[model samples]
Target chain A: MSVKLAGELQSGNVIIVENNPVVVLKAQYNKSGRNSAVVKVRMKNLMTERISEAIYKADEKLEGVMLERKDCTYSYYAAPMQVFVDSEFNPYEIHEETLADITKYLIPDMTDVCEVTFYEGRPISVLLPKTIIREVEYTEPVVRGDTSGKITKTAVLKHTKHELQVSGFVEIGDKIEIDTETGDFKKRIA
Target chain B: MRRWDLFCRVVDNYGDIGICWRLARQLADHDGEGEIHVRLWVDDLESFAKLCPAIAPRSPVQAVGSVEVCHWSTNFPSVDPADVVIEAFACELPLTYIAAMARRPTPPVWINLEYLSAEDWVEDCHLLPSPHPTSPLKKYFFFPGFTSRTGGLLRERDLMSTRVAFDAAAEAVFWQSIGIPPRGNEDLRVSLFCYENSAVPEFLQSCVEGPTPIRVLTAPGAATEQVSRWLGRGLVTGELVRVGALAVHAIPFLSQDDYDWLLWSCDVNFVRGEDSFVRAQWAQRPFVWQIYPQDKDAHFVKLGAFLSRFLHGVSEPTVISDCWQAWNGRGRISFAWPNYVANLAEIRRYGEVWACQLDHAEDLANNLIRFVREQV
Candidate 1:
C-alpha cells in the first residue's frame, strides 16, 4: 500500500523511491502555506547503502516496500554467507554482501536473537538491537585520572573487530554495552 | 536551447497549471533564444484553460504562443523525453515515458519540483538527487523557497518593471472597466479572494457596521459565495449591494494578469493558495492569507512560519499578526480590524521594502534553467 501524505512516513518505513528500496532515516514536515505543504525525508538506500535526502508534497503518495521480519539466532558462517536459524531451527543463509556494513557487528556466537528481514524470498538485511554487549578485543591501559567517559578513548570489540570509544578506565578484558545504531559506548561491566 | 517537457497534474484548481504555464512561458522566452521547444503536459485541460484562455479544453495538443500544451491522459503514448523533464509538484511522469528516458543514450535531466515553503529545511533538501534503482538515472528534487539557496519564487523578466510603471490613470480605467464606480479615499477598497472561510460572515458584519465605508471587489468563488449566502441572493457580475457602510461589487473571474492588477489597485488583498499568495507579494500591497485548511491543523504551522518570517522586521508586527490571526479563525476579525486598518501606512511601506528584498532572490525558471544547464 502507498504511504498517504509524505508526512506520515516515519523512521524505518521501507519505501521504493526512484525504484530503489530505501529506509527512511528521518521525516520532517514543514508547510509554509495552505497549498504549500511538504515533507522532507532523509533516506538510506538499502541496496546501494548510500544516504540521500528527498522532498515530497505533504499529500503525495509514496510506494512502500513490504518486508517480512523474523526473529532468528545466528548459527554459523558458510563462507560468503552467514547462516541463521529461528527458534524452530529453520535454517536460513544470507549473503555477506547483503548484510553490507552490518556484517562487522555479526558476532556468530554472542550476537544471538537478531532480526532478519526477507524481501522477495531472500534475506536482504539484518536489524541489530539498539544496544549490544561485546567484550573488548584490545585497548591500552586506562590513562591515569581520565575517569570521565564523556570524552572517549578508542577500544576494539572482540570477534567483530569493530572499533568503539570507551572510558579511559576500561581494560582489554572488560565487557561494555554499546549502542548499535550510533556505535557509542553505553556502559561497562568488568 | 533544448526541448523541455514539463508535466503538471491539477491536484486542486488553477495553481498547478498557473505555475506550469508561467514556467513554460518563461523557459520558452529565453534570452537570445537558440530555438528551444517547450511542451507542457497537463492531466486536466479544463482547469488549465481557466488559467490560460488560449487552451482548448478538449484538444489533445494546443499551441499557446511559444509553448505547446498537451492533454496528458492515462493512455500516455511513449515518446522521446526532452533534454529536461520537470515533474511539477512531484506529479510522477508516465511509466512508459520514464522507461523511455532511461533507454536514451544520455537520459534526460529529471527534476521533481517541490511546493514552495518558508521552512528552514527547504535549503538542505534543495537540488538533492534521488537515484533510480532499476535504471541508471537520477532525479533531482527542486525546492521553491524564499531564500537564494532555493529555486526561488516564480517571476517573469518584466513583472517588476511593469508593476513599477503601473499608471494611476490606467488603474482608474480598470475600475471603470470592472463596473466599479470612482472610489473615495476614505472608502477601503479591498479584494476578497479566499477559500470557504467561516470567519467571513463576521468580517462582513464588521465592514458593514464600521465607521469607514468599504468597497469590496470579489471574484465568483468562495468569498463571493459567502457574501451571496449572507445576502440571500447570488451575486452577478457588476451587481452592487450595499448594507450599512459595506458595499460589494461582484466582478467576473479575472485572468492572472488582471488579478495582479486587482491586487495592485486594492488597499488590501485577501489572497489564498500558492499562486495568488505569491502574486499578492509581488503586488506590494498589504494582504491577508487564508491558507487552505489541512487535515490535522498543519496549515496553522505554515501560517505561523510565514507570518513570523514576513512580519519579523515590520514596524508594527502585532497589528498585522492580530489581523492575520483573526483572518485565519484565531480571533474575532471585528476586534482586530480597527488596529489592523490603523497601521496601513506602515504595512504599505513594509510591503515595498519586503518586495525589494525578495526581488534579489533567483527566480524559479532561471534557477531551473541554470541547474539543467550544468547537468547537460
Candidate 2:
C-alpha cells in the first residue's frame, strides 16, 4: 500500500524511503493560502536504528512497508538489553537504544504482554499496552486552596522510575493508571 | 537569467488566475541585468480574461503584458521545463513535462504554493521539502501569511507609491466614467462584493431603515443578484435601484487597478476571497470580509483566527467583530449595524495601522524571487 500526500501521513506507519523501511515517529502538516500543503516528519530507520528527518509535498505518494507482529511477554532487563519471551518460549533481546521512547515505560520482571513488530525476521519495535497500572514513588503535596485537578504536578513511577505528570491531588504511593502513548495519567486505582 | 513556469487551474473562480497573473507580471517586469522569462499556463482563459482584459479568450498563445499567456489545452505539449516550476494551488504539472524535468542534468526548483492562513502552525511548515516518492526531485512548500516567519502578501513594487500620488481629478473622472455621481460627505459611499449568504436580506433591510443614507456601488455578481431579488426588480449594468435611504447601483466589474481605486474611494468595503480580501486590507479602509465558507464551518475558524490577530490590543472589538461575524452569517448585521457605523473612525484608523505593520514584512513576489535566486 502507498500513502499519497504528506497531509495524510501519521505516526506509527511504516514507509519505504530510498529503499529503506522507515517508521514515522512524528508528522507535522502545514497548508498555505491556496497551494499544496507540506508534511515534515521525524522517522526512525528500521534497518540501521538511526533517526532521520524528511519533509515532502503533502500530496507525494510513499510506498508503505508492512510489519509482522507477535504477542510476547516482557521477562527482564539486563543492563543495556531488555528481554521478552514469546508464546513459543523464544527469547528476543532489544537494546535500550533500540527501544527508543518505550524503554521508559517497560516494567522489569513483569509478565505484561507486548506486541513486537518484525520487519524481515528482525524485531524492529514494540507496542506497549494502552493503559498500565503502576505505583507512584513520590509527589509534592497539593498547594493550599488549589484543590482542583486542573493543575498538574510531576510524580515518579516506583518500579520504572519514569516521570509522569499527574493531578494535583496525586500523593506518594498512589496507584494510578497511565496511558503509554500519550504519557497522560488516566485514572487512580487506589 | 531565470525562466519560470506557472501552472494554474481555474477551480471555478478567477482567483487562481488573478494571483498567478500578478506574480508573473511582477517577475517578468523585474529590472535585472539578466531579464526573467515567465510562461503562464492557465486551464481557463475565460476566467483569466475576466481579471486581466489583455488576454484574448480564444487564443492558444498571446503576449499579455510582460508574460506569455498559454491557454493550457487537454493534450500535453512537448516542451522543456523552466528553471523554476510553480504548481500554483496544488494543480499538478503535466506528467510528460515532469518526466522531462527529471531528465535534465539539474532539475527545476519546484515549489508548491499553499493557501494563505494566519494560524501559528503555518510558520513551522513553511519551506519544508517534499521529495518525489519515485522521481529524484524535491519540491518546496511556500506559504503566504501575515507574519514575517511565512511568505508575505502579494504587493506590487509601485502599488503604494502610485496610490499616494493618485490625483483626485482623475478619481472624479473615474467615478463619472463608471456612471456614479459625485459623493457628498453625508452620503456614505460603499463598494459591495461578496459571495451568496442567507444574511444579505437582513443587511439590506438595516441599510434601508438606517439613520443615515448610504449609496452602495455594487458589481454584477452574486451580491447584485441577491440585492435585486430583495427589491423584487431586475438590475442591469449602470442602473440604480433605490428604496428608502438605500441605493444600490449595478456596476460592471472593473479592472484590477480600477478596482483598487474603487476600494480607495469607498468609505467602507465588503470584499470576499483571498485576492480582494488582501487588497481591501491594503486599501486602508474599514472593510468586512465574507469568508468563503467551507464544510463544517471550517472557514469560521479561519475568520476568527484572522480577527484575533487584526484586533489584537484594541480597546473595543465587539462593534467590528460582531459586524464581521454578522457579515459571515455567524451573527446578525442588523443588530450590530448601529454600533458598527458609530465606531467607523476607530476601525478605519486601526486598519491603517494594521496595514502599516503588515507592510514591514517581506512581500511574496520579492521573497519568491530571492528563493529562486538561491535555488537557481
Give candidate 2's error at residue B105 in angstroms. Answer: 1.1
Candidate 1 ranges beyond 4 A from true positions: A1-50, A55-190, B32-35
Candidate 1, residues B1-376: lDDT per residue as tens digits? 6899999998876777888888899889967436669999999998877777878999998899999888899999777899999998778899899889988999999998877767677788789776553468788889888988899998988899999998798788778877787655878999999888888888999999988898888777787889999888999878999999999988887778878889999999998878888999999999988877876777777678788889887767889888988898899899998777878888989998989999998789889888987897
Q: Against the correct fold, how does model 2 do in TM-score?
A: 0.91
* Pairs in clash, predicted candidate 1: none
lDDT of each: 0.82, 0.82
**TM-score of each predicted structure versus truth:** 0.77, 0.91
Stretches off by above 4 angstroms in model 2 are A1-8, A29-39, A45-60, A73-104, A142-165
